[model samples]
Target: MGILANTVSFRQYQVLGDPPAGDPGEWAGPLLAKNAFVPIDSGSEEISSGWVCLDDPQNGSFAERRDFFRPPSLAFTLRRDQRRVPAALLRRHLQKAEEEFLAAHPGLHRVPKDKREELRDTVKGALLARTLPTPSFFDAVWDLERGLLTFTGTSPNIAEIFEGLFRQTFEGLRLVVLHPFARARALLPAKLQPLLEEQNRAATDAVLEQIQENTWLGADFLHWLLAHSVAGRNSFRVRRAGPALMDEAFVAFLDNRLVLAAGPQRVTVAGPQDHYSEARIALDAGKEIAEAGIFMEKGEDAWKTTLKAETFLFGSFKAPGVKPEKDGITDEKSEREAIFYERMHVLAEGLQLFDSLLLAFLEERLAADWPKRREQLQRLLGFEEQ
Candidate 1:
């Protein structure tokens, strides 16, 4: 689903480097237009990818500021078209071609390797030309003021493609995945940042190293939240900054599904878990939470998402739906703009609530009395031994 959808799954990226100094719309307008999507329907290319309008994939124009630029935010969609040929069909065609070649030459028992390869290429090209291209659209919203980008897709291959395209389109700028440790460091206060750095397990500044080495951050946070929820301690105060007021009370808990992993083996516990007995068993077996469905609510607003522990990616994130509230709105364009801003507003608020919950966990996890709290949590989970 796209960003406008009621439920969307996405990965967050931290944009690095700086853009050309000028009216952002001035330089960005040309860049988006220059790298706009081109139709591959007439060509036999296997794949093609480029930027398109967020609302209309068929429209790639970015001439005006209203087209893609939304002040400090730029929204666009990455459209990828791919053509595939069945391997079995290709093999059959190649075999028939080889038989025809052998029949034409009476003395030849088999086609030569060079001739066979040539025939295979010809067959593949023919099959590709006859095949229709499948198109996919992934939406992206880049918050220039915050240097953060949210992409409405979670596939690793698609993310790699998006990163490459983003780097190519915007010269000098690159994207860094906002892994657990990086996010933790970003969320920590100035006083606690040094303490977080003290707990860093990665030997290098590489992204993968940061994520793989500090996976405990996510696992322990989920474990803490799970334990708290089981103990009926689901209320927390907002600590990190954003749309939510500081010290505002919110409720968050883990339920519906929980994924636990121990090395190569993994277990998924689904449905409405009463006291999460099955998950507790897995936890006792030394499996750490790799993912879980997190639900947060504050007053009338609510958000739900399956959060991937390692990468902190949100899967099937459902934010509060918004509609145009302006009475007597006759113009479609104005209505769309109104809905867009409302969606962004709620999205930001959801993210803020999540970050606040994480901060609450971090403050406890990083404190000097953490060992005592850990012992208490272990006791609550019936893990008194370790």
Candidate 2:
């Protein structure tokens, strides 16, 4: 992995134990870190993935810590979206569907009128169902920091424990809206660089040592799942093998591709579609929804798309937790998009501020190269080099 490259999910967890020691610097606990991390592509798809750290190392350790990767909860689904459609349009669609229904069942016309009326009600409901537009989402978050570990979590409790731990560990802490992998990479100066590298290495070594002593813990989890999750020629249950499945999931979480749903339902990306725009290029940028049948949709809202030249949010991964709510489109006159940019500017500013502080702590080592380094990264803080 490059300096900014990542191979694990560094999720913002509600650290359950202690609080930060001094300044209460806060930071989020990454996901898929057990801490192991996997890498992924820009579109939240799996590219190259692996274990950054395993509960049990190759050498034996906790009965193999294996996570059972299950598909999205889509099988037993109930439409929960609340957007309503115009009653008139619904009636129109229902009437057209009834005509087709009656033509298909000439014998039904001969039945009692009351019985037909009841059947019509049932048919109309199915026919009148309208599509709900996809939702628009934005990032909303806040935080404070302490010493040792950065305590950042969406919840108050997560932040509290994060603070406590840093207080105890005197490591450092961080709390903010965005994921810190890339940001954390940016924080390391020559002096403190070794600090983070040491922590990462220390964690890895401890895991390996534990495994060597407690051997059964190494692959026990994998074996248990292998004998159970895979049966009958790699059927629909699990599309990939045990190790590969876990590896991919870790990659997905790290990449923010794993979305948590409310119930047990299966979700799969609609295979593919075609599209053309102004001839600069003709291609497909679409996503599909498939249950008993398939529903095709296009546009940026479809399939979490981004134009090639767009300054894509780099918010590539889909993390599990709360799904963002969808509000109707804002009128251009409202300057909604501009307002949004302003808010994000504020957040990006706060993170950048902390970035400066993090660098200051290591100033002694980076003093020689700080000038050039700052010039290169100034764009991150809305500045340009002279």
Best by TM-score: 1
Q: What lDDT would candidate 2 get against the real structure?
A: 0.27
Once superposed on the true structure, which residue ranges of model 1 sit more than 4 Å away at CA?
A: 324-329
Model 2: ten consecutive residues of lowest lDDT:
70-79
State in Å the error of residue 147, model 2.
28
Model 1 C-alpha lDDT versus the unseen true structure: 0.90
lDDT tens readout by residue for model 2, 11-60: 22222333333321111222222222222212222122222211111211
lDDT score for residue 2 of model 1: 91
Residue 29, model 1, lDDT: 74
Tell me how far the alpha carbon of residue 245 in candidate 2 is from the true structure, in angstroms, after superposition.
48
Assess candidate 1 and give its TM-score to the true structure.
0.97
